[model samples]
Target: MEESKPMLRLKRTLTKGNLWLYILSELKRGRVYAYGLSKKIEKEFGWSHGLITSYVVLYKLENEGLISSEFEGRRKYYKITKKGSEELRKAKRYLQQLLNKL
Candidate 1:
């Protein structure tokens, strides 16, 4: 029997750790919806995950006060909150420091 590698495990980890960062980055561009976020991630990362993942991340971020959302018709439009901006700044700083060490 052949062993199978767990596909998306690494991606899932990266997404879990960096999901907020990704959402913040997207919001920095402008207000966006879950579907838009999913498409952006797919285009930028080349992964084909569904919109639910993005919605879940957005929901968590909203609950954590990292982001805010408003209902526009049937869709929820999201924006990075002040806390989200700070989180993005911290993540960017950390990433920069790590890259500098490399």
Candidate 2:
């Protein structure tokens, strides 16, 4: 029998800003296009994200200098910069601290 909607686990949907860590972490893996980043987020973290939101965050990060992007033909690939790495470390620590309190 097919599972009913109530019996099925809902897909985890994340708000736009919630993706900072996922993007940064994936960028650490290598440079990534915004589309690829969003797919990886869903695949690895089970968080469903919209393409426009992901690109918005990407542009924000780039503007903040936490990430840099380059155009290869029509694709823009992003990589975390040193500052972004520092921020990622700080974010990890914050998460750790939050978990410890729970």
Candidate 3:
């Protein structure tokens, strides 16, 4: 019997490479609601993931303390926290260094 390699879909989905960076960039602009963020990402980068995915990422980021959110009517508005900004800076620098190596 042959052994099978484990699939790594979660890593790919979560990392999402530069798409995650772009999401951070958009969040840095100001507090944005989920639909707005999704639209911005789609318009700016042509990323067209489902609305649930955007909300899930936002939830994860907030849970990680990288971002903060407030309730507005029936919607939740999200903004980058200080820690999120710091992480964004670090990520940008890391990406730049990686690009330079390439």
Q: Which candidate gets the maximum lDDT versus the true structure?
A: 2
Query: What does candidate 1 score on TM?
Result: 0.79
Candidate 1 positional error at 44, Å:
2.8
Worst 10 residues of 1 by lDDT: 2-11
Task: Write candidate 3's Cα lDDT for 25-99 as tens digits.
Answer: 899998899889888988877657777878777878889898889998998899998988999999889869988
The sequence of per-residue lDDT tens digits that candidate 2 reaches over residues 36-64 is 88898889877677899888888899999
The candidate maximizing TM-score is: 2
* Candidate 1 RMSD to the real structure: 3.6
Residue 33, candidate 2: how far off, in angstroms?
Answer: 0.5
TM-score of 3: 0.79
State model 2's lDDT. 0.84
Q: What's the TM-score of every candidate structure?
A: 0.79, 0.82, 0.79
- Residue pairs that clash (backbone atoms under 3 angstroms), model 1: none
